[model samples]
Target: MAQGSSSPGDDAGNLDKTFREWQDDGSSEVATLGGVYGGANGVNHMVLNVRDMEKSHDFWTRVMRLEHCGTQGGPGQPRFLRFYRSHGHTHHDIALSPAKDPDSLPIPTGPLQTPGLNHFAWTYPDLETWKQQVRHVVDTGYPIQFRMEHGMSQSLYVRDPDGTVVEMMYEFPEERWNENIEAALEYRRVLDIDNDPDYFDPKPEDMPLFDENGLAEAS
Candidate 1:
C-alpha cells in the first residue's frame, strides 16, 4: 500500500529544501554527510549492554520468543549472548553483553521524552498485521511509545526491559518511498545542512512523535 505523506509540520519540507540546496552547490560533502555511499541497507542488528547475560538471555528467549544464537567467550572473554527471532537471519537481530553493573548504564527512568537512540525498527510485510501486533502489545500491558505515519513507513515503537526502544514498521510501497526519497533530496538541496533532519535530531517530537509508552503515534 502507499505509505501516507508526513504530517504538515513534519520535517519533510525542511529535508526537501536542504537536499535541493546541496545539489546546487556541486559539493561532494552531502554524499559523505548523508552516508549515501553506504547505500540503504536495513538494520543489521543492535548490540546492548545488560547487567546479567544469563538473566537477559532468559528474558529474551522465554518472554520475547527470540532464539538464543549462542554466547561469546567460554569462561573469561566477556560474556555476550546473541538472540534472533526464530524466523530471522543475519546472525542475530539483537545482542546482549553483560554490564558490570546495571546502574552504570543510564536507563530511562523518566518519560519517553528524554533523548538518545529512540528505537531500532524492524520492518513488517503489511500495515494491518502491524496494527494487530500493536494491539496485542497494548492488550498484553506492554508500553506503547507511539505510532507514526512516516511518509515512507508506518511504524510502532515500544521499549524493551532495559528501556532500549524498539520499533516495528512497514515500508511504503516502492513508488511512494521513491517519491519521498526525491522529496528528501529536494529538502537537502534547499537546506545547507549536511544530512536530513529525519535521520538525525534526537528529539521525540521532531517528525515522529511517540505516545506515553514511547510508541510512535500515527500522524
Candidate 2:
C-alpha cells in the first residue's frame, strides 16, 4: 500500500486471474450488492420541445402507440401542451410543445443523436412485444439508427419527428447483470435489424471487464 510499491493498480497477473475465474464459473456466479430502498418510486412524466406537434403526435401516437390524454390551452388552461397517458401509464408519460427557433439549434445527426441530449428510453413489456414495435417502425418507413444488444437490454435506437434518438427496449432479468454491473455495462454487441429480430437468439457471453476508467491497460 506504500507509494512506488507493487500494488493491484500496478499489477495485471492478479486481475487477469480473477477475470479468468469469473469466465470459468459461468454467468450465474455473479457478485451483487444490496441497496437500501429510497422513498422514490420511478419516472412518472416528462416534457420536451418538439419541432412540430402534429408530426410529433403522429410519431408518438402511431409508432410508439402512446394514448393521447388531452392538451392544455382549452378554455381555462392557458398552456398549449399535448399530454400523453396523463394518468394510467403515469401521471403524464410525456408532454410535448413546439420548440422556439428550432431551426437555430444544431441538428441531431449522431447514431444516438448526441447534441443537446443523447437519448431517452421507453420500456416494452417483453422482447416479443418490443419486436412487434420494431416491425411497425419498419413498415412505417422510419429509419432505425442502431440496433443493440446491451448487457441489460435489447434496444432499438430510433428517430422521433424532431430527430431525437428515442430508445425502445426491454430489460433482461436481474440475474443477467445483477452481479458486477460495471462489467455487464461494458457488454455491448451490434445487432442487425433484419436478421437479428431477436438479438437474444444466441445470447451474449464473455462480457469484457474494463478498468474503472475503461483504459486499455489495467492502469
Candidate 3:
C-alpha cells in the first residue's frame, strides 16, 4: 500500500507490511523526491484568484459561512485572506488572492467546454444543518443551480457572484448509507430544477432508485 492508500482488508500489522513492500518497489521514489512524500493525501485548502478580494472575502465569510481565521501583511504586499470553519481543526479551509484583472482571463472553448473546476462541495453535519443551509441560500437570494439526492447525500448547488458553482450537502442518514450499490448503478436519479423558481422553498427529498426502465417516480 502507498503511504495514504486504503484497502478493505487493511489492518494494523497488514497495513505496515503493505507500506513496507510499496516503499521498496521503487514507487515511493517520486513521492520522496524532495526529502519526504509531498504527494497530496487529502484536501487541505483551496485558494482562488478572484476579481475583488473584498467581495470574494465577504461572500465566503458572511454568506458561505466560513470564519475569517487569519491575516498577513500591512498594505503593500499581495492582498490575501484565510478562512476556516468554526469546528474544523485546519487553520484555514479556504483562501483568496486578488487577480490583477479578472475580465482579461481567457475564456474556455469548444463544445465539451474544455476543462476547469466545476464546483467544490461543503458538507453540513446533519440533515437539519443542511436545511438551514438551503434556507440561507434562499434568504440571500443566491442563484440555485439545482437540488439532488444521491441516496447517500442530499445536495444544493448554488452560484456565487463569480458564477462558480458551490455544492452544499449533508450525508443521508446512516441507515441509508448501506443501500444497494447495484440499485444506485442501475437507476441513477437527479432532480431537474433549472427552470423552476420555487425549487428552493421546500426541502428536497431523495428520489426513488431508478427502475428497470431507468426512470424514477416524480415527486
Candidate 4:
C-alpha cells in the first residue's frame, strides 16, 4: 500500500505521482521579472482594537507623532479615532476601535503560546526624518525597546498602550537596492550594518551608485 493511500489503487496514494499531476496541470504562471507585477501600491491604513479609545488616541497622535484627522461615533457609544492630520491627506492612515467588552483585558488578547504579529513597520524618507522621529519619541517619553542598524535599514521599536510593537525604520539608500537584492538571493543573510562603524555615517565614496533612471541604471 502507498504511504498516504486510503486505497491501494487511489491516485492520492502516491505523493510523488500527485505532485507530478499538479505540475503538469499548466494552470499557473511565474513571473520571469521577479517582482510583484500588479501588487497593492502600499499599505493604506490599519485598525487596532483597544480597551480604551481615548488612551489609544492620545498615544497614537501625541506619542507616535501622527495627526488627529477626524472621527466617527460618539462619546459613551462605539467610538472611532482617526489620525492623518500631518502624515497625509488620506481619510485616515491609522484608526482605533474601542473593545466592546468593558471588562476585556487591556493587554493583547491573542494566544500567549503562539507567535503572532511580531510588529509592523513604518518607513521614513531619509536619516534626517528618522532623527526627528527619535526626538519626538524621546520628548514624549515613550518607551524605546531597541534601536539598531539592521543592515538594510536603521530601526527603532516602540510599544504602544496595548503592548503592540511598532517599528520605525529608515531604509538605506535606494541606489543600493540592487545590492540588497543580490545579497538576499545569493547569501540569504541580512547585511549587518551594525558591524561596520562607518555605516552610522557614510562618506560620499561609500554611497552606492545611483542614476535618476533608478536601479536599472545602477545595475
> Each model's TM-score, in the order given?
0.56, 0.68, 0.65, 0.64
Q: RMSD in Å for candidate 2, one decimal?
A: 13.0
Give me the displacement of residue 130 in model 1, in angstroms: 2.1
Q: By TM-score, is 2 or 3 better?
A: 2
Name the better of 1 and 4 by lDDT.
4
What pairs collide in candidate 2? none
Task: Show the lowest summed lDDT stretch of 10 residues, model 4.
Answer: 31-40
lDDT of 4 by residue, 110-198 (tens): 43344666678888877778768866886777777766554356667777787788888777765455545654223212223347444
Shift of residue 140 alpha carbon in model 3, Å: 1.0
Superposed on all Cα atoms, the candidates' RMSDs to the truth, in angstroms, are 14.1, 13.0, 6.7, 11.4
Q: Say what the RMSD of model 1 is.
A: 14.1
Determine which window of 10 residues in candidate 1 has minimal summed lDDT: 184-193
Candidate 3, 58-139: lDDT as tens digits: 7887678888887765334766555556455768877776667789975332222447787888888876777787878768
- Whole-model Cα lDDT per candidate? 0.55, 0.66, 0.62, 0.60
Winning candidate number (lDDT) = 2
Candidate with maximal TM-score: 2
Report lDDT (Cα) of residue 75, candidate 3.
Answer: 30
How high is the lDDT of residue 77 in model 1? 62
Q: What digit string (tens of lDDT, one per residue) describes model 1 on residues 108-149?
A: 755667656766777766656555555556566666666555
